[model samples]
Target: MSARTLGRARGPLKGSVSVPGDKSVGHRALLLGTLAEGTLSVRGLSAGQDVASTRRCLEAMGARFEDAPGHLRVLGVGLRGLKAPKAPLDCANSGTTMRLLMGVLSGQDFPATLAGDESLSRRPMERVAAPLRLMGSSIATTDGKPPVRVAGGTPLKGIRYALPVASAQVKSAVLLAGLYAQGETAVEDPFGTRDHTERMLAFLGHPGPLRSDKALTVPGDPSSAAFFAAAAALVPGSRLTLTRVLLNEGRLGFFTALKEMGARVSWERGGVHARETVGDVVVEHGPLKPLRLAASRVPGLVDEVPLLAVLCAFAEGESRLEGLAELRHKESDRLEGTAASLRALGAEARVEGEALVVVGPARWRGGRVETRGDHRIAMAFAVAALGGAGPVELSDAACAAVSYPSFFSDLEAAGA
Candidate 1:
């Protein structure tokens, strides 16, 4: 148990921080770059271990890479050129690497097993497997979890799948498999999950002109930016600036929640990169209203739920987050972990059916936060501790390296 005790903030946090590149976009860009038949120069790839797992897996399958400051160059192996990996793909803690590559491996001519850490091995993988099977790919999960095995030479035929739930990973898996299918593979995503995969595919000329620029710049991650924003919102008189964050509509649920909670959240659209919108976001402290989150918005809000739950821990009303059953399958059972984190922060919180209801104006009387080895939860608790009345001891502070390696240091520099 790697622990860190965060002292209470004595003053409002004020600073500008550039978060790491968007992890979702970074994963898609690297994967698509592997399929493109030219040198793909990528700027600002995510430095987290999850994206590192993706890059390592791609390399094991014969993609070569060149490295330089703030840039990574992928020598394309082309769509049909990936060789059989020399060993089982070790995905570590990245569910994204295992899940998305399950789609990519399904269409390959060699057998592969997508394995991950114990945490990831327990996550549901059948959501991706069932659809890949429909497309004639042979996939077997360990009772609907990881160690997902993909058999070789299973010729694919694309089928339009209507998602039983809104999951961007599942959608991307099926679509990536669609690339090798005999017919058009289409996924009807009515819930509007982040389309980073679709956009990257289009930008890489999947069904359009193949003349895309070889260089791709990834936007800064919005999910990482949310923690500082939440801290600034909770700490009175605070102002924090986050530069070059991804501004996709699907990724803006946290911002919407922030706005409804009365934080002065503002942004300016700056430019576009790899078919993603980039912008600078500023968050300021204000009187917070309790968040009344609807169930329909769950898909877009999935990653931000914990951070929002932290905000709800201090907001001035009863905050109810519905349709969070998906939270149970993450690195931890976050639905319960979130309620627990709120309670630890001195708020009344519970799970009533599929909804998590938090009643706040939290007293910030902090104690030990149980992270359950999940990086996002660890980071959220760091924010909770930043605005706390007492120091918080996190159970797994080192887990933040899975995504945001510099999180604690950045928190300090940005006014912890």
Candidate 2:
């Protein structure tokens, strides 16, 4: 669809929903599985275009998947077995796929070139390349951007690198390279990013002894659940529970920020595997208070800030988001997109430095918003449409297909 309007709920929303698998984990699972020995099976894989890109690319490198009874069975070739692709690896619009895959491919013994769509091509890959280069990986790129050439089989050695910011993509890139390095690879984040790559690695049988409350040391991801959590929060009468979402200390700050702002959320301990924590979440209708998100906490919710901005519109007071300057360089200039979307809904929003301050509890007037081909921006605005003062029509709604193809369907099933 070119564009579509989300009808406003007359009253409180009610129902149950099962959000698709975590996007971050979906990507890592596919990649790690390809590097693991024997058969690996994945459940709750996200049906998003980005994750699908990784799947297809992996298949092209000689990995295979089987549709099994309860999961997708992946036959991994282990490290050093991946063959060079016949053509350049096309990552579509996924920045994570390109950046992290570059690290993984860097240590291999084949020459691989990674390319992407226009958006991905513009994203900076130099940050990742810097550390990979330190590991002795020969990486050549056009001014730190995509269409990157990595001559694999470099003599890589482990290095301790401190991130200038909290970015899971960079962290995962280093960790993925560590898998091929001669020594241990450690990435220290000033502020924590998502831990999905770390968590999935632990689950898949490579649990690292990483410290928490300071810097996470694993190779997993948790940013993937932010979208699903937002959907649960927006669907008023909805009472959906996701099974086995990782709750690393650094990543839990988003939920803490939400609770401080007064969202009705609860957790239940579930089974565990591969030394990673697993649990369930139940969200229901409740009053939401506004929150002042500082720069210190920005790394925790970096990927979810767009969705949280949508939540701010439904809150009781003004919400301020700081340390969001990193967003300027994402798939799109998300800070501008977030502000523009809030304006479309009649909420007062402005950008100061790297912070986004949203004055709200203002009604979302059903107006058309351009997503600028950013998936997070599209999905976040879609959630806001549920609370619109009128029906909200989002242009470029197709972008949601990149990370959450069934987002609308899932929301509808939840009675939104």
Candidate 3:
């Protein structure tokens, strides 16, 4: 059963919360590692059901896995070592799992079919499939939706492609397909996006040489750290440190936006892992001011928009977020769900074309929030509920389990 928010959090949210491991990396570690030689051991892995779908898909392709709570041991099948599944691969609610898996399957010799839940079935797969098709892989979709069929052994060859918009998943799909392609595959993002897949790929020893300085290269995911950052800020007197967060130029845009808006966020003990910036973040209560956003920084914080909206609700002044046109195609129209959730909490929000404007520190009262079955929306509202807004009841709270199965328990551990 779904849990209910009784009232605003009144006590000092105490203790340390080791939030789930990076969902993006956890998926990559399982999938890519399964494709490599030798055994792969993943620690602090996300137990989220969505990532689990990736693990299961890999296992179906001849990759054996022994999962122990937070630790997962996966046996690698070497390059091009996957076996065709006996049945269509069900991706559940994960677009990432399905899209990226297509890239992996594109370079193989056997056929595999990809399908998913209603939400995943509705997402556009054409973006990745078109690129894969260009690489000589024969892939078909039902009217640009899921239940995708792939006929492998297409002698894949890579080509440089420009992104119509900045999307990590699309870029990652192309890059992963490039792994087994005959030549170099380069993705040119005029507007850069997240590089978690790239960084983690490099960390695991298989990333292609990336050209930087023009784009905000993938930075470590502060998206995963956002919850604790908010927790530390809201918990009053709590000082929680987020260790080893990637600080790629593209990824740090969130921190930059938040800092500009007056959130008490900072980086500590910066280091490098396989050339990517790694650092810690410390957050405390501060008078958060409103921040302005536009095209240049939108792609960097795309995944964090929902949590950013929650922060906007608690900030002083009007927070403006623009260039969200792409948010429309995510698991749900995030722009609409975000604004609608704010309105449910008695806050003021509006959408102008692709931009969203939120007026903050408004009374967040009780109301029902329709999640649209998106994981981020489900989790974002959970953070909102801690504001003591009158009984914020969420419909489809189960959605959070997709990316963060223990989200509520972690929030509780942090004294929410």
Predicted model with the maximum lDDT:
1
Ranked candidates, highest lDDT first: 1, 3, 2
Q: Estimate each model's TM-score.
A: 0.98, 0.90, 0.90
The digit string of per-residue lDDT tens for model 3 on 1-416 reads: 36445455656665444556666766777777777666666666766788889988888888887766545676777776789899999899888899899898898899999999887888888988998888888999989999999999889998898987677888888888898888889999888777777766666566633211111112234676776676566545666666667666777776776677665778864766544676777666666777688867888888889878888888878988989988888889999999998898899999989888999887877788888888788777777777555578778887788777777777777677
TM-score-better candidate, 1 vs 3? 1
Evaluated at residue 22, the lDDT of candidate 3 is: 65
Better of 2 and 3 by TM-score: 3
RMSD of each: 1.3, 4.4, 4.4
Task: Quote the lDDT for 352 in model 1.
Answer: 97
The C-alpha local distance difference test score for the whole of candidate 2 amounts to 0.76
lDDT per residue as tens, model 1, 130-219: 999999999899989978889968899999999898899999999999888898999999888889998898888879533334898888
Estimate, for each residue in 1-416, the C-alpha lDDT of model 2 and write its tens digit: 46878766445545434556666667877888778777765666777899889988887788888877656777778877789899999999988789889888988899988999999899898988998999999998888798999998778999999997668898999999988888888988766677767766776667442211111122123454555566556656645565566655666766677667666777665655444555766666567778898898887777788888888878878888988999988889999999988888788889998989887688656787888898888778777776554477778888888877777776666566
